[model samples]
Target chain A: MSEPFRFHTRLNLVELLGRRAGTVRELLTGIREVPGASIYHHTHRFLQQHHFLSPEPPNDFAYWISGSLGLNDIGERLASIDTVRYRRINDLRTRYVEILEEALAARRNSWPVCQESDEFHFMSCRTFIIPLPAVARDAGEFLDILGRISVNSLYYHVFESRLWLERGENDFAVWFEARGDHELAGALARLDPYTITLEGLRQEIIGLVRRHVQDR
Target chain B: MSRIDDYVPVAGASEVEELRLLAARLEGKTIRNVNSTAVGGGVAEILTRMLPLLKELGVDARWDVIKGNERFFAVTKNMHNALHGMDVPVTGDDLDFFVDVNRRNAAEMDLASDILFIHDPQPIALVERKGDLGGKWIWRCHIDFTDPRPEIWAFLKGYIERYDGAVFSAPAFSRPLSVRQVLISPSIDPLSDKNRDLGEDEIDRVCAGYGIDRGRPIVTQISRFDYLKDPVGVIKAYRMVKEHMDCQLVLAGGGATDDPEGLRVLDEVKREAEGDPDVLVLFLPPASDIEINALQRASSVVLQKSLKEGFGLTVAEALWKAKPVIASAVGGIPLQIAHKYSGILTRTVEGAAFWIKQLLQEPEYARKLGVNGREHIRANYLITRHIRDYLLLFLSLYFEKDVIRL
Candidate 1:
């Protein structure tokens, strides 16, 4: 057997950059100038914080643009960015910037501004990834530990590692493919993680892995 | 005194274990929390409950109360009001006295620890001893900084910048400072007396003791008799709701003895509710957590009509009990409510009255809101999450990078 898959989880602490924007123009500047950490924080904050209730929650930019600035058209476009398709934070950020630039061009004369209290405060987070006690030596052991691990551990493996960390594939799929399970690895890779809740994703993965383990 | 293990069921078992892991990183460090008043305010209450859990997690946590005279408190009180944008008169001498009091407390107390966490404006000046103490200092501001008085903010800014970092209850409270600023929202202990689950018998007995009838739908606002809480606006909203249906309003809280303005506001509320029999005005004594819990549980709709607020933990408390809440979108109240998802957020007295009437008329919708609200509080506003954030914050100070692998 290959090396064991070490399960790791992260604890994130959010910090306010003390920069705020009331208009789309200012938001564009912030999206361009702020570090990638700030961009990651805004896009993925709700997923980490509200893992239990997930109806494909919108990013902070979409939420503020629609709810506060009354720009549902551009907000919807931003929300439909297909986060799973982007393999890196810079790519996701570039897409957001492009959307805002188009919005700016279309509404050059009629730009709306949010109230002073309603401005979007830019924030970033620091994360500490620590090893959990759980490790899986084989597919059966991986399936067993997947059901009981914290949602945070699952999130780090599936979402954070796949997209923002630019790993090209989720850790589980990578592990499976390395173990010569091409069919199961492809199946896990095809799943769209953004559309489902964290727990829902866990169940789906468990079902797929269970079928493979039983067939073996 | 509920132990850390007692919160395992409330906050999931996995989360409790996760907190232990986060605390393990800071196993040998000592964290000293300095605040004013061992009783009464939110900071003290949180420290009282949190110190033991932190210690149980193997972090040597201790709390120290800064000493101050009544005159010093008065000056600091004015400073506090001024920081909230109120035009309170505070002279230069008063500022000097505030610093002098902190200097005296610094001399008397043991200022040695790996982390010195100073809470609020009273002990803010204690940062002056950082050179002698030689440790990381963090100032946790628990107030709204939307529009602070310039003179008072200028005075505090000098001291605030001297610290290694600052913590604000909400993003709105953060000021543009040179030091690092983190956003850490305040939390409610679910196992605490004010938030613990009460039996139907205890709830009914407490309501009966307060002369409340369980037959009518009850609307409650649990806050002190302060103008910022907008107790009078609450009565106005309740009267508007009363015009539509048969409902009762409960305004219950204490701690009005020290503030003369609180006494005046209490009297004004009485006059406004003089002829209304359904309006029950309760000025409960301190340590009335069980009564407050019962009042919230018995309430059909909970309200927090604050014109200005810090974080409005009452909203979280009511939501934790799965009760529908209507609160103003000021300060951190917006952080708790998602506007008709978990709970309702209002901007005016009419908006509040409309939601109150709508929720009472529609039972199923109200139930859904309450259920969603409980889940929201379970995920975000519990003390377990707060402790996790603090542990991460303590660890963040030692690492300069955004992502760390340990």
Candidate 2:
């Protein structure tokens, strides 16, 4: 028999890299140079931290650009990037670098610099993944455990696993597809996690699994 | 003190259950927290509430207060100011005595816990025993370390680099260090008397007892009497606001046992007040949590106005009460406030006065800000989140790699 799906949760240890950027050129340089973990942090911090209230929280770069540097045009463009579309952090990094380069190309002479204290601080997180006691052997068991596990666990399986770890699809979808449940797996792989709160995402997954079990 | 389950209603059942899951990873590991004082200060206040909940969750958590004499405290106070980037002098003798006190404490205390969590500079030197004691040492720095004095930083850096990890409250407060650094912001206990919801009659009673008229708008700032808090500057801003409208100012907080300059700063604040009946500069005791809660709940606008700060838990406390806050854009205050969205961020006394007047005149706008501020605190800055991060940090010490599965 195939192995059971062991649910896992994560706690992030955020570390400051001691690098900051006040001007657009410096930001682009830091983006290109800092570790991929740092880029992942600035993008996914809001999603993990604001798991309850926010449905569509902007990444730190978008917030800092528009809110601190008052660059609304580029900030909007950065915010509109569909993070769910990319499965690898390096690909995501390439998209952000392209956006910053486009902003600079448009305005060659006038470069915006934020206040001295308002520079963007580069940070990265070392994640500690801990497996939970909850395990799922079938779609029914998966639905039950998914409803009870912490939203943090849901975030890890859905967002961090699929994107930052370069997994083509989330662990849930992979597990089901491995069990010959292609329809459920495809449905889960299509869900946009960035557009909903973690709780809403949990409920949506539960609904899909419950329906799949009934259909089977 | 409230239990872990008591936080269920405020932090939600899922968040509370998550703490138990995280604490499970740290089961059987003894985590002992060491700080300078057992009473007064933010570190003590947090440990007082946090240690019990950790015990309830089956973690062998203990708190120990390091011993220091008057000379030792005075030297540490100078170190504290210097670390906040003040032009305070640190003598050669001062560094000698600081290490001497830590050495004495380290000898007497049990430094053999699985995890020894050192809080702030006062007990930082105890990391010297890590090689002998053979435990993971985490140095928790809860100060504004953005621009620390070179001599004091170099002195502390020797001990700091020996630790397994260092924890800073804000990214701005962190330094480039060989020891792995983590950013865990300080939090507010939402169920504590100091932040708990108060009845209308109780809030009115406390304000009236403090000689504050409940009829007029009240602007309050609750912090220890320290120069870094800028109590005198708070009065200047209050006076500027008073020139525009008829209102009252309540500046209330107590002194910490470790801070020797509190009374002197209180005197400076009283002199600045100059017996203005509208300016109520009351020196509260350590047990004035309910009174502090009532004062914050009754205030029309709250101010934090610190020249330098260490996360400014008061900003989170005020924000938890859904009071529109105008805090200085320093240290971790910026992390708590969203600059005119959740609360207004100010840079000067005049700017604070300007926002105080603007918020007072626009009552509806102020209410919206308070509502949004409380939600931000709920999502980010609560004791539940703090405990989760600490447990994760403790678990991380064992797992040397980036991602470890159970």
The DockQ assigned to candidate 1 is 0.75
> For model 2, how does the per-residue alpha-carbon lDDT over B292-386 read when each residue is reduced to its tens digit?
99999999999999987778889999999999999998889988887777899888999999999999999999998898789889878999889
> Interface root mean square deviation of every model, in Å?
1.3, 2.2
Off by over 4 Å in 1: none
The number of residue pairs in model 1 that clash at the backbone is 0
Candidate 2 total steric clashes: 0
TM-score of model 2 (CA atoms): 0.89
Considering only chain B, report the TM-score of each candidate against the true chain B. Answer: 0.96, 0.91
- At residue A81, give the lDDT of candidate 2: 94
Query: Could you tell me which residue pairs clash in candidate 1?
Result: none
